[model samples]
Target: MSFRSEPFLWIHLAGLAVLPLFLELTWLGLAIAESLVPVWLELILLAIVGIVPIAWMQWQKPFDIFSLLFVALQPQQLTSQQRQILRLFKTRKHRVLTLFAVLAMGWALWKLAVFAPLAAPAAARLTQSRGLGLGLAIVGFLGSNLFLQVPISVLGVLLTSNGQFEVTEPLTPEEVSQSVTVLGFRVGNILPTVASNNL
Candidate 1:
């Protein structure tokens, strides 16, 4: 089956990847509001923590990342071999492990971002203003999901396919032929009837 046909699976995987990030950001924002941290330092640290890994991944596997985005927009028709590779992800064990991996990675990153020497002060400041803290959390959550997590997940799927699928041209609908009905009615058969000169 094509990846597009499995909406539930994609949704599940996305939730697995982003929910932890949302919670982590919310907590970080709350913490930040409570501390006297340098906003510039916090922004710089966040940029380094988030962008560096993604940049490295993009550099290492440019094709995989591009293919992921392409496939996401126009899902490729899978070959039997490609389907076999995808089936592994559908298994209970793999599904559970994937969820765990995403969660573990998020947890590790959150700890790194919040507890690291320079970041610790910034994260501590999140709790000082509840409204601002939550606002930052919401914006961060949406931005990260849209720009970071989703692309990473797509890249993972493309890598799993192992370049087995081909990008086919888009399918177009064929023209329908006119036919006669059982009752002798001309269905979809348009014709001009000539009138007799005498009539």
Candidate 2:
């Protein structure tokens, strides 16, 4: 929490952030290479792309995820309300990033899934260069990850929140805990809440 430890904190976060980026790049690279090479080469490259980060992640967050998994798996004395309270914590969205990501993924999926299926026989006549297919595939795969990032971040937030004790209130603690009313009918609470001792 002090100024001196901030550098180390950011350094670790920076390293963790780099992991997903490498994965996205590797996936897109594989996609581009899919149509160009033999199966064995593809498999070897895929293994390298996938396994290395997982090993790194194991080093980074080795104990935490496993312990959480165990806590979640076995039946516990957790109240039903306590369980619902956990779902309140969600990732905040970035409009610009979300829009750009959607556009990229939509374009990529169209080119790969829709156009490729329709253009199969005509591909030979259409592509002037041998590399176009690979190019499109790479773009498509990367685009998939682009749109996927927000959702993945949301998941990561949820996973990490599970270990925490604080619960944030968007408006006020009182209103947040109150049941939401819609047009005269009580629908439900905006979000469930946990103890505010940490907050």
Candidate 3:
């Protein structure tokens, strides 16, 4: 096969060089390297399958229309403070979101590492046997679900802070004064009412 026809030859070779990353714990590094062919093939196939729906959706609408929808439904209207908030959100870790994401991904990565050794021999056995291959494929299918959570969570964080705010535009002095008065009245209402309790 010509190198040009191998869409993922480079990626496969690169994965080989970096396989040790998954093998960081020396004793747990017992990978049946030969068995990785089916796993890697499944990864490629899954990527294409996953991308097709997104591609179709985008193709159904001009991207500018999608952008317009995004803008219209966005929680806040665009303003200078919103723009600054968005920039801050993009560059900084929303600690609550990032903490949960990292914890979840870290757990999955740990499980993958722990199971890698046990999976190696089964992977080897499956490569040579048809029924076993089907079973392994089912296992691979189930395992892929765990890998998808991280990306989904990341997308959630990105959408939340799409950066629109009311503070950026200047408010008239009269408007500010009215707001202060309303806020002061609202604050004063919080005290306990002795007459109501006596009744």
Q: Name the best candidate (by lDDT).
A: 1
- Highest TM-score among the candidates is held by which one? 1
Pick by TM-score: 1 or 3, better one: 1
> Regarding lDDT, does 2 or 3 come out ahead?
2
- How large an RMSD does model 3 have? 19.6
lDDT at position 117, candidate 1: 41
The true-versus-predicted C-alpha distance at residue 162 of model 1, in Å, is 12
**Per-residue lDDT of 1-199 in model 2, one digit per residue for the tens?**
1121212122323443553454344334333322556644543443334333333322222211101211321113222333232223222322333344445444444443323434444454444443655444444344334225334333333344433424433323233233211112222221124112211
C-alpha RMSD by candidate, in order = 17.9, 15.6, 19.6
Evaluated at residue 25, the lDDT of candidate 1 is 65
Clashes of each: 14, 0, 0
For model 2, what is the error of residue 74's alpha carbon versus the real structure, in angstroms, after optimal superposition?
A: 42
Model 1, position 185: C-alpha lDDT score: 23
Candidate 1, 1-199: lDDT as tens digits: 3544333234434544665565466446635444356644554444455444443333322212112222321113222332343333333443343344445445544664465444447666444574576466545644453344434444355454434334322222110011100112222211112111111
Tell me the TM-score of model 1: 0.32
lDDT of 3: 0.32
List of clashing residue pairs for candidate 3? none
